[model samples]
Structures are given as structure tokens and as C-alpha cells.
Target: MQRRKVTLKLYPNAAQSARLEAWTRLHCELYNAALEERIDAWHKARKSISYYDQQNVLPQIKADRPELNELGSHALQQTLRRLDLAFQLFFRRVKAGQTPGFPRFKAAKRFAGFAYPDSAGWRLMQHGGSGATLRIGTGEAAMSIRARGRHRFGVEAKPNDITLTRRNGQWFVSVTLRVPESACARRRTGDQRRGVDFGINDWATFDDGRTIDNPRWLREELPRLAALQRQRARKKGSLRFKRLGRRIARLHERIGNLRRDFVHKETTRMVRQCAILATEQLAPKTMSRSARGTVDAPGRRVRQKAGLNREILSAGFGMVHPMLAYKAEEAGTRLHLSNTRQIKPSQRCSACWELVPKTLSQRMHVCPCGHTAPRDRNSALVVLIDAFNTQHTPGTGVAARPKPLPRQRGKSKSVTRETPTTAPLGA
Candidate 1:
């Protein structure tokens, strides 16, 4: 499935805003009530209630309460559907050993209405303009308009939730669109495979020894950002403080936009170049703990590392792999997830086939057997070898094998050694 998201700046008149607020409240109420009903049913029968069953009751309820018709029957039904979906997700997570709490009532600042694929509650007011019109309630008081992007297409806007959010004194609506799966299939396909290593020193390392250095804009701007924040705090709610707050927010926005741009460009380039891509499965929360420094210089190093880690996270190293997987599928390419631990791509010698243990600070690969190369390049070669072996192995397991020491011409042969050990690779 292909999904498109468009965020529009909403301009709602005072009356329209009030009506939208009421609709949001009603939607939230229906959602909570539906959730309560499902929980009661599940408690009684010990079986999950299906979304369709809950949806089927919407029309009857709408008919019984004619007053809710003005709030948009389609919207109310969509809210119920979302509530059902939320419960389904929570149940799934609980089964996976996750602590997923029950769905709770939506609060005002966090409230949003919904529209389904089959609902008529949502429509595109203007097909092409600075902004499009959206009708939330029956009356004109609920009508709102928003700006449009430069690109105008004849594609019809499917009924979906328009989430209203207030950020930086601006009202915005996140519009979700369902597009044909073929839309993102324009990428090229290739047979080459790749492995990626993510690091704080270098944002990412390819099997080919290429490294994308982290920009660390936040680290660079931290002093200015801290100063502005301090100024804002000292000034409190005064006009000067508000102005400083806006400045700080804008600085953050700038850094975020830059990071996003960099990730998009880098991921697109990598995806277009290789068909099959592999990367380490990283847990950001676990990784962040190691980023702190010693007690002596705790704050300095911790802040610096944290800033760098944040940039790496925002760069979407983890997200890029999944995106490439689906994008590769659309492009008729195969994307594989390889076991990085067993691979030991970084520690293995590519030329001499010896295990070369090195610290993170070592940027060059120097073998005692007279082989030398860039660390990242050597790691990449090791990854390629692992991939080749994985494809050739009969079973799914990554069995260990002795490293083939480099042969020397005219030298005497020595006795060989053999050892059986557990495989290093695990998915």
C-alpha cells in the first residue's frame, strides 16, 4: 500500500473554530464509549470484538440520536473505527510482551476527528488553490480553508481524518491520503547488495568504506539555543520573552528541517544504487545509555554525545532500512536483513581472513600480515563475504568457519588447527 501525507496550515474563522472544537469533543466521546463497550464485551466473552461489529452499530446509534447528525455521522463512525483499531493494536502489543495500556479518553489539546475510506464526512473544497476548503460540521460555521502546495493533481482526496494541531502559534492539519502502490515504484533496480553500519563518529558506514559524517547542527547551535531559552525563562510571559521563545523554536525548526533534508537525500541515493541492503538492528534507548561520559566531565561529553545521537536518530538510519525494503519491493528488487553480530564485519580482516580487533577510535585497518586499508572499507568487504556465505549455506543458520590465513610463496607449511564454535550471526 502507498500512503501520502500532506500538512496544511488551517485558517478557521472564530465561529468555525468553535464548531470544530465541538465536533472534536463529540468524536472523542464516541471513541471512548466505543472502547468501553468493546472492553466490556471482551471481559464477558474473553474474545476480542471485531471492528466491523462495532461499525455496524454506528448507523443505528446515529438514527437514535438525531442531534449528533449535525456533528457528522460519517465522522462519528470513523471515530469508532479508530477506537477499535487502537484496541486491536494494544492487544497485539500485549501479546508481544509489551506493556500496552487501554485506550483512554482523548483530551482537548490532543483531540482529533476521523473520516474513513467509505465516509462522506470529508471532502476537498478546492482542487487547486493556496489552500483547500474542509467542512467539519453541517453548518457554514464549521467550514475551514487551508493552503495548497505548488503541485496540483487531478487525484481525488479520499475521506480521512484531518488532525488539527497547534504548534508555534500556527494551526495545522495533517491530511493522510491513500495513493496507488505504483506511485513509489519509480526507483531503479539493481543486483548489488550492501551492508550499513551506524555510528556516532560517522553517521553511517557502507560496506564500501564510504562514510557520511554527522552534521551535528544541534551541537553547534547549543550555546545560542541555551542562551535564547535562558532569556525567555528570565523574561517569563512578557512580550520580549515570547519573542525569544519564537526565536528558539525557529532555531529548532531550522535544525530539524536540515537534518530531514540530509536523510532524504542520503537514503534516496543509497536506495537507488543498491537493490539489497542490510543494516544492524539498533535499539536507540539502549544505545543512548552508553553515550554518556565519565563523572569528571559528565555534562560536557554527555550533552555532546546526546546531541550527536539525536542527529543520528533524526537522520532515520533505522527508518531508512524499512523504507528501502518496501521501496525495493516496488522496484522489483530484494531487500534482506542480515545478522550483523555474527558477521563481525568491522572486526574481520577482508584480505588476510584474520580477526583484527580494534577500538572505535581506530579509523584504519592495519593487519600484522602487511595488509592495510581504511577500516570502513575492510568492514564492508567482510560484510560482502558474509552475504556470499549466507546465500551459499544450505540451512538458515550462520555456522562458523576457520579464517583462511594468507598464503606465502616458498614458505614451509605448518600444522593446521580446527575448532568448533557457535555461529556469531543472529537475526
Candidate 2:
């Protein structure tokens, strides 16, 4: 059994919407209050507060604040659990020699939502189609919400857990259910092994020279986004300003949805087609790091670098690797990631195995050995070559290819492109 989470967009009437907002506010308050208790206990008496230590006093808290009773105990406990997890992560990061950002109190608006740990507080009603009805709480206090979304697999087992989340004024219920692995398996339609290169301009470039054009969603929406920002800047605390903020939020939500939808579809395409996949081990965080140096020495091309970072982030290429990984598991496809820094696929020649450095603007890969192709295609080839026929010699950073490997049985064989081989001509 695999745990699959299905998120459904919820449609609620005015009363239901009000109730959700109230519960969300209550959960946020509980989280903040619990955080305060931990801080005070630690500072005043040098005492550390555990989750159960705070949980044991919940009954008294509910009694003191009767309003919390309507929110359900399981959901309230999950809020405390979230805080405990936050602290746990902080401690773990500290022990790992990383920055341990202490947990800060979240405003009610910042608190997205809350979770129910188990079947106690929620129930899902499936009607065979894509849609379902989610019932929260029980008896007279039960709030039945109409959920609209498509489920990939049949959810027959009891719900593992339920989380109610609010994103940009929209309510979503993500239900985790235990489903059969067979039902979750992806169907493969193609047997070709391929390497993929993700880019900021183009979404993906395959070793075969086929390109999936980048939607450039953020770029297309920028004009309207800029206009809205300009309007909001003119009035800091006005009714029109608040309305503009909501409009901006809705636009952001739309952009996010478009990106997610495209990613899922494209990933599914790869999962269904390729039997073996190779890609670069991209580090988006390192690539998009700020270029602003300290006062002693300032950075060059700050605005240009900032714009490049935005483009890198907007492309959402980092999501491809993880998406391919999980989808590979379901499709029985092999996924390999070549070391980006060491291999330097973008610079290394796939044919001669020599370094062929080129500027970012130069989209064509041209080598002295008469090997040439699109830069991205060559990069994908380098990645694929590294995955199969090359290995680095000990104590040396250079990778050595013993011999040429057999080509993949792909749809279109490359007659024009040079295959990565160390063998002599006509050998």
C-alpha cells in the first residue's frame, strides 16, 4: 500500500467559509500560545517544554478558552505537533552546523491551515467520479464541504489523515489515503532511454534534439503584475489597496496553478515515454544565490544577476528531478543524475570528452573535433554519456571512457549528431 495525497478545491457557502476562517484563526492562536509557553518556560526556569508537556495541559486550556472546543481536539493537537516539528528541525539544523532559525509566532493571516492526524475529525465521501464531499467534525457541528478535483486512483481504504489548507483565499482539503500500489502504477508507452536537460528559456531539451518550449509564465504575466504593484504602492492603507492586494494574490494563485499543471503533464509525458532517464543534478539554490556582496566589495551586474535568478526560479526546473524520481518508481523507469559541478555537462564535449566552454548566450555547441549540436542537446548527451560509458580515474578529476556504448533504441536515430566514442574512424 502506498500513501497518496489527493488535494481537492473546496466550495463553501458564506457560513462555511466563515467557520473555516474562524477555525484557522483558532489554530493559529493555539500555535502562538504554545510557542510562548516554551519560550517563557525556558527563559525563566531553564526548563525545556516537550510536546506532551504542553499537550497534557490542553484540557485546562480548552476550559479556560471555551471557543477552542468547536475546533476539535485532533486538529488542535496537530497544531502543537507542527510547532514541535518546527523546533525539532531547528535543533537538527543546529547540530548539523547549519543556521537554526528559531520558531517565530505566525500571524493569523500567515497561518495557512491546520491538520487532523487521523479519521477522528474528518470523513471523505467518494461518489465514483472525480469529485467528493468532505465532512469535518461530527453531529450538529459537522461542516460538509463540496470538493472539486480529479483523483487519479480509487480511494477505497480509510483516510490516513486530512489537512485543511488555505492558499490565496482559496480553501483546499488534502486527504491522504492508503491505496493499492497496482492502482498507482504508471503505464509506460515508450521504451527509449533518454537524457533530459532543463533550461530557463526552454522547459526541457532531450538528447535527441527535441525541445519542449518553456511557457515563461512569469514573464508573460509581468506587465499586469507591474501595474498592480504600482497601484498598491500609491496607497498604503486604503480599501482599493486591499482589493488590489487580493487581485495580486489571485493572479499569483493562477500563475502557480498554470506552472503546476504544466509540470505534472510534462513529467507524466517523460514517465510514460522513457525507460531510462538521465539528467543533471541541478542546485537551484546555489545557482540563484544573491550577488550582493558586503560593503567592502560590491558585486557586478547586480540587476542582471537578479533578473537571471528570477528567470531561473520562474522556470521551475528544480521540480523536474524529484518529479521524475517518484514517477520513475511508478513507471519502472531508471533515473540517473550526473554530478553537475564535476561533470560540467554544459562545458564538456560529449564526443571528444574535451572541455568546450561557451557563454550562456551561445546556444550552439561547437568543438574543434567537428562535433556540434544545440548546447542543451549536447549537455543532455554529456549527461547520458557520463551515466553509461564514462568513469573518473582515481586521484584525477578527468573522466575516462573505455569504449563507446551501444546506442539507445530511440524513435529517431541521430545521423547528423556525433556519438560519444573513443574509437578510431571505421574501427
Residue-level lDDT of model 1, residues 163-205, one tens digit each, is 5555554566676766565554545544557767666677778
Give each model's whole-structure lDDT: 0.62, 0.81
TM per prediction: 0.69, 0.90
Winning model by lDDT: 2
Lowest summed lDDT across 10 adjacent residues in model 2 is found at: 418-427
Candidate 2 local lDDT, 1-427, one digit each (tens):
8888878899988999999999899999999999999999999999999999989899999999988887788889889999999999999999999999999999999899999998897888876676788899776789988988767775455579988899878899888878887887888888777889999767899999899999988999999999999999998899999999999999988888898889999998996887767777888999999898879999988999999998898888778777777787787776667667666889988888778889989999999999989999999998777655432221212233454223322222121111122212111
Per-residue error for 381 in candidate 2, Å, reads 1.1
Best candidate per TM-score, number?
A: 2
Error of 1 at 58 (Å): 5.7
In model 1, the Cα lDDT at residue 93 comes to 89
